[model samples]
Target: MLRLGNPGRRISVGLIGMTFVLSIFAGRLIQLQGLDSKVYTAKAAEQRVRPEKLPARRGAITDADGHELALTLEAREIFIDPSVVSAAKRDQVATALAAELGVQKEPIMAKLAAGGRYQQVAAAVDPTVAQRIMDRDFKGVGSKHRYRRDYPGGDLAGTLLGFVGSDGTGLSGLESTYNKLLAGRDGEQFVETGLEGQRIPMTGGTLKAPVDGGSVRLTVNRDIQWAAQKAIADQVKAVGARTGSAIVMDVQTGHLLAMANAPELDLKNWQKAPPEDWVNRSVTDVFEPGSTNKVITAAAALESGAVRPESVFSVRDNIRCADQVLRDSHPHPMERLTFSGVVATSSNVGTILAAQKVGDEKLYGMLQRFGFGVKPGSGLPGEEAGLLPDWRNWSGSQRCTVAYGQGVSVTALQTASVYQTIANGGTRVTPRIVAGTTNGEGVFTPSAPGARTRVIGERTAKEIAGMLEAAVSTDGTGNLAAIDGYRVAGKTGTAMRYDTRCQGYCGYTSTFVGFAPADKPRLVVLAVVQDPQKGHYGGEIAAPVFKKVMTFALKSKKIPPTGTRPPAVRIRAGE
Candidate 1:
């Protein structure tokens, strides 16, 4: 430099050095102010505060008797912060977590080494295990408050209560239907963290508390439901059927006392069940009601002044309509059957003739009034409206077939409602599952009561119910449905399942729809066996099942017998 051999080189070197220094300063400023601001701010806040989550408690579900069917309890989701996990101790931490969570060690190690600051290793951990993990004082492992819906009754009301998903969402039954009311809001707080990545002792921001969901009280009688389920399951197993469903309703109040299904699954493990087992067939599936639909036909005839209980119809051996010839199960060559006998015998020819007399328009109108082809407005989720052909499109044989429940399709709930109308003295009432709502003060306020519409005169319902009683009498077709002390008015249905090869109907859907305590009816029950073994008949299969369920239901409700005993008569062999 002293010699100054190259003055130009010296000046250029000086300029380059100055530019490099300026660039370094600018880059540092940009990174510190822009790129790292969020991290720095979070670190600073972490040093001064600690925040927490406030989880809303899910509402409980109770039966009519105040028995807890479903409830929510505190649960925890175990999580970890890899940023706080010591590199030297990573293997130990992963191994411990994997062992505790019943998972493989390699997976846990991979998750921990993934380099994320926070991760959920496991959720819904057992309280004791969560406590152990918390006690370990590991900076990475922690837990948060969550809700786990528990059914103390287990599979008892699983089908009705439904199960919750991993995200705490309801997926079926009442849980799915009332999710909005059941799933309360979630609240969170902002907290400070320390240099070691531990939550600080102070809260930095405002606090917001979660609002709890309202409790739901249902009208389902737990005891009766238990009994009904047991009976239905037993019958389903005994009959070697694919599946079965039963519904017990309060005829007067339109309250569903009990809903039962066979091949029941535990709500906690609903995911493991078969697809068919999860279906609530009582309201979802529709089948040709077979002779059980004759009740509607008879009601229409009786209500429209088309026929009387004492009125007689000469049922021929066969009545041809269009390409089809309708015949009774048993051949009758122009027999004199009283209006009551027509139903008691479950004669297809007689029912068709009676429906013709009632006319298609009037019959269709009555069907609509009775809640057929339309949704029952039961508030149950995924309820099918069922299929009812319009009057204009109905074929000549279609009308007759529908009259005896061959062409038309209906759910068990729809069938039960028909009986419910008869039991309620011909007034149609909407059915309800929820009993009431709890107020802010925890006082239960009854829900808006169901509305009843007069479908037919009281005298008509009584007359029809009387004739129905004769159908289940000792000499009636549904003799197997008779309960010793209770007067049951019911009909048997055995329609073949639809098959393409048989030209139309093939397999059978056996069913029975009936009410008990005929004098002062208290309960209406509908039972159906989807596809049974060879001896598939409603009177043979479904009737006995109804008798069992009805007997239990009456005894459970303590419904006193209202009338003197009819002299004991032997049930006929063929009946």
Candidate 2:
């Protein structure tokens, strides 16, 4: 084995082995430098560069005439890298940021003193203030560009406008409903960053430009909205109610001009409000429609040819419906009243008599046609399709009660739509809040009109309108809903509100629904006050609110009163 034989052969093999090893190394070098160089280079660069987000601007929500309800403004998200700042300079830097940003120094100091590479100092800071902090050029202090959602009206349409979160996402209300439309596509920018997530100055990388979101134009009118909100808020407070809602609808369009609620959410400080107050109660909360549903029963009777406006009924103070006894709103001697007068008086006994003529199926069918048991589709989030049990399943009392808007539930928006149907000549138009949307290029595209269905005949609607007009007459239950110099038409509702906590009827839901210039119907306004401590009657509580809001709306729109006299309807047989 130690023969040292073939020394020349061994030497050649050794050289060949060395060459093979070197060839392998050379091939690897070529692959790294030539074939996959871009891949490797990118990996190396990726370690050095970090991606930064470029937030897109959220869309503006405007009123009908282009008044801003909600809008986006440029802002800064100020953050800090504590490791970069020296201990001695921490307080000084924190002080400067706090002073310039108008924030308390203690919070900034607490954040700065913490041992970390990064921490948020403040959010939604003004750009100008952020710039001032940057001018100092303190180490570790940085500001990122972001959009801040601004509410110009504060709590004006707070419940309707909803609010945005710190992460720039819509959280509730219309914000949540049309979030995709309001939130635009975000973009990205790559910048050279150090190992500590700090952006290296002057080393620019690729950018993907952001696309800003489109704007939403609502059918809501600003002045009218303000008036409605004020009126409802005042009335709710005056009545000491748990909550209240008011709605104003365009008779011809079914467009919601103003939807107001009490105990409204403040868009500025939405977090401070109770979660229950966040919903749009106009379309969310449901209660027995009470006398407001009488119109539906009347329609059934007339449309089925079971009764006429002139048909008379001998109505007593109280009538028995199944095992339960139903009574008129007030006690009175038996009187001979025409069908119109029965409605004008809001007599449950009289209404039940009329419903008997229409029968259960016919009355239920009429209610369905008028949009009961269906959501109003007002484009507002949290809207409910109120409870309407099948007529066949109705109880003995419920059968009669449903005729006068009892043992059934309906939302304020739905109640208003009932009046809108009559006001619009028997056409039921789905309620809508949004008027149009504007694209990034500032081109506005109008929204398609709401779906319209004829729920009652024109003749039937006119007859109901006349009856409603009689309700606002001097002797009717809704007389207080009358407007000076204008023939007003409406109904009053005082329903026993079903409170879930009590598991029974607890308080009353006062409601007054009406349209002005009765013959020339322009607007339908509904006022509802729930669980009030002061008063419960619709005429006493809700009607005044309607008059106040309707008056403002009429003058606001310059809808002059039609000077024609209202035709007299016989309430008494002799008359």
Candidate 3:
């Protein structure tokens, strides 16, 4: 050991060294406590405050009877924080997720290698499946709550009901029409978090509650709609037709009870089907009205007093009009038939003869009055207004053809509306499908009923109804449409289908529109089959389906027929 030269001098130097060291530490403490406090505090706050989305619950779609057609269910989105997952535990997590989630391990490995902080591994996972995965407690794995739309009825009212996209938006049909009413306002929330992005305990933050959407109730009857769908689908398949549609309307209210289309979209897996399946063809497709439109001519004639139900006409196989010689559907010898007989038999020559008296303007006026040449205002997606050239645009051939139910176009909806007017005793009602809506508070609001307008006199409508009833008799064309217990009134139609593929007419559009319990019509059902290969005549292919649907509607409503025999109408001059 070395001895100190001076004890007091040594002690003084040691004290100075110690004091200098203490001052350096004190200066650093002051800088940290005052100068940089705010910056550090703000950085900590930035890490603590977290913003999150609060998804609003979408509404439900129910039928007229409060049965669910579409609904939303709770789901989950499972993801992995690949960047935070330990390399040693990555394989274990991936293997666990693959086995538990039923996903391939290769994809999981790829996502891990991609090293994203928030990498989605699965979406729309069922709650049960998500719960199982969460119970594993794997590191860097998490799930967020989400919603998935479900169509409970499957394809029951598929195209008519439409579907929703993954982003919780309506894509087609009524879903698209009522999107705003169905998708309520979404909300946001702020929560405190830790540096590792963990939520803080006991920290209340700002929140905006979501407003759930309102529920929609449709006018469609589930049983009736299902029946119509089955009937039309069977007919289309039986006839080997390209497509078909069936519409059943409440005559008095014009409420569309059922709008059925063959080959409707698979609501849950709609993406796999063709886009054409998304269309409500009853409102979308338009074609020549065929003989079904002759009722408009008949209504015009009777309403104008140009012809009477008992008026006599000299019928022949063919008649000359303008530059064309129009003929009846079947070749026949010259025979005198009453006006009622002509309609009952669906004679083209007699219809043209009557049309000659009604002229173009009056006939066009009647057509318009019966809801032709315009959109039906049914609020369906892709509704076409249908082609109706102005009366002045009628060609020489079109002049005579228009008189009988050709050279003009109308949708199945328009044709149904025509029959609905006759069935509703001359008053034409606007067709509607939405019955009402329900708010989040559970208060119900009924949609306004369809508008009604008288299109013809009650006496003229009765006369036409008699003629339509005669058409369903044994001597008539639509005999197949007659139900055993009901005095049915209907018309058969076979028109040249204007094929878009060929840009011209190719196959036939077979149709039958009618109402049952004719004396007090409750329902008007229309069935249409397009481009049939097995059979083409409306009476053969379309009439039976009309009968099936009408019977079901009548039974569903408990509408017993009047049970009176149909009135006898003269079919020939000799009678």
Candidate 4:
């Protein structure tokens, strides 16, 4: 081994090396302890400080006439933090909470004794009950205010307005469709806390206030909605039909004034009701449109220049399409009739013959233009765009069958839209339900206005109006739909219902779709009753209801009568 001559110098150098390492470790400790506050502050905030959610108020739903349909109010929720209760007194707390909350004592005792740090027992208690529970002064029990939705209209527009869920979210109807606009942001608070997680004194917390949601204004007219609901309820109950739907739209604006369905539900308590009652059948359900679809065929023919109101055809003497023989309800063998006469009698044979002249291409184009087989874009959830088989997909005899409103399907709103098209001078507009919003200051911010798209020319629309008028005259087949002092134009539809039993058509659906004051129309009303007991004819079951509703609607609106008489048509020997 070699001996070092400078032992003192070597010792000093080693000591200096050790001192530098210790200084480096001390500097790192100071950096971690003092330089970064966000990390330590966040860690401290997470351990003892409990984050509390700031509740927000939901938006309101109003009618076009400024009537409140749904609103939200401040409500209280009672809860218990079981950790705060002493083990000896835990039984007492459980018993008191169970009786006050209407729950069994055993469950309450089990929950309190489970020893979870922050356990909530009962929630959503009304203020009276919440106050009573708080009066006990139980260490663990407490109450907090929350926003609860209320529907003042009750079942008036229940299905349309829809209901909200427990998480303060919109679940259905206008609520679900406009949920983003209805749900407000959640605000939170972080407070410095003590040993038992109790908020500390002199330590201020951070809070961000919640922003409430915007309001929704609907196109519904409350008075008209009430009247329509009453009439439909009375009729549906009288006839004993399974269920019914009534939809009224502004003929001029294409705005859905009222869309009502039965049986109605209360939005406040949706859990107690059957799931099926929550459906808005007016837009979601599809059925064979029946003769109510005749207007479509007639419009196609007139617009395509294939047939005229005066054009004549030989009504079936029995026209056969594959296995089905297309015939009028009351066959007048080899009956000669004009295009207008075909619709007046709702002659299936005549409509099909006219469809032959118009053909599939023109008919399909017309249906597409009129918004059939497609969603009305009303912004409601679960809206089914009724099935419309492509013209190319149509099989043997399919074209003819589709002519008289068969081999196709549509929703009530789609059927009504076709009539609203004619009533609005051939321009089709989107059907709307929500009107616009109004601030708490009573300043109304109307929804973006609807646009008009021209579907048929002015002359063709006028001729179509004249033909519809002729159908409802005292001498015509739809005379049951005629109203006194008003020239009403409408069609009655009796279509066979779809059956899954034999996997073929089984029952029938009675439908009436029409607009009033045919000369200068203002309102378009559509009512559908599924499977009436005895009388199934649309003319019998649906037309009179249509008249009753139209008469009341006109009188209610104070609309003056159209003094002009329907155009006269001369019958030829062959026609």
Sort the candidates on lDDT, descending order. Answer: 2, 3, 1, 4
**Which pairs of residues have clashing backbones in candidate 1?**
46-192, 46-193, 47-193, 49-192, 50-192, 50-202, 51-191, 496-507, 497-507, 497-508
Error (Å) of candidate 2 at residue 141 is 0.8
| Model 4 lDDT-worst window of ten | 566-575
Error of 3 at 374 (Å): 2.0
Best by lDDT: 2
Error of 1 at 176 (Å): 2.2
The lDDT of each candidate is 0.82, 0.91, 0.89, 0.81
Output candidate 3 Cα RMSD: 2.8
Give each model's clash number.
10, 0, 0, 3
Candidate 4 runs further than 4 Å off? 1-48, 86-110, 192-204, 331-333, 438-444, 567-575
**Model 4, range 109-197, lDDT digits (tens) per residue?**
78777876666676566678788887877776767778778888788878888898888788888888877776766677766666554
Write down the worst ten-residue block by lDDT for model 2: 197-206
Residue 87 alpha-carbon offset, candidate 2, angstroms: 1.8
Quick one: best TM-score, which candidate? Answer: 3
Which sections of candidate 2 miss by over 4 Å?
1-47, 104-106, 194-202
| TM-score-based ranking | 3, 2, 1, 4
Candidate 4 positional error at 463, Å: 1.8
TM-score of each: 0.88, 0.92, 0.93, 0.86
lDDT by residue for model 1 over 1-575, one digit each (tens)?
47646988888999999889989998988888889988888776665666667777777789998898988887888888888888988898887888777888887788788877678887677777788878877768778767778888778767778878888788888888877777777676777666665665653565786777777899999988888788788888888887788899999899999888887768777888987677677888788888888877887898889887777777887999899877889875678777777888888888888998999888888888888898888888778989889988998789788888877888888889988998899998898888986742476789787888998889989887877888888667889998887778888889988755567765678888899888788999888987787479898888888888899889888898887654332222222
Clashing pairs in 3: none
lDDT per residue as tens, model 2, 1-575: 67766989999999999999999999999999999999999998977877888888999999999999999999999999888888899889988887787879998888877878779988788898899888898878888988899998889988998998888899998888888888988998888878666678889765898888889999999999999999999999998999999999999999999999998788998999999998889988989989999999999999999999999999999999889999998899999999999999898999999999989998888888887888887768888999999988999999999999988899999999999999999998888899999888789999899999999999999999999999999879888888899999999999999999999999999999999889999999999999999989999999999999999999999999899999989887889
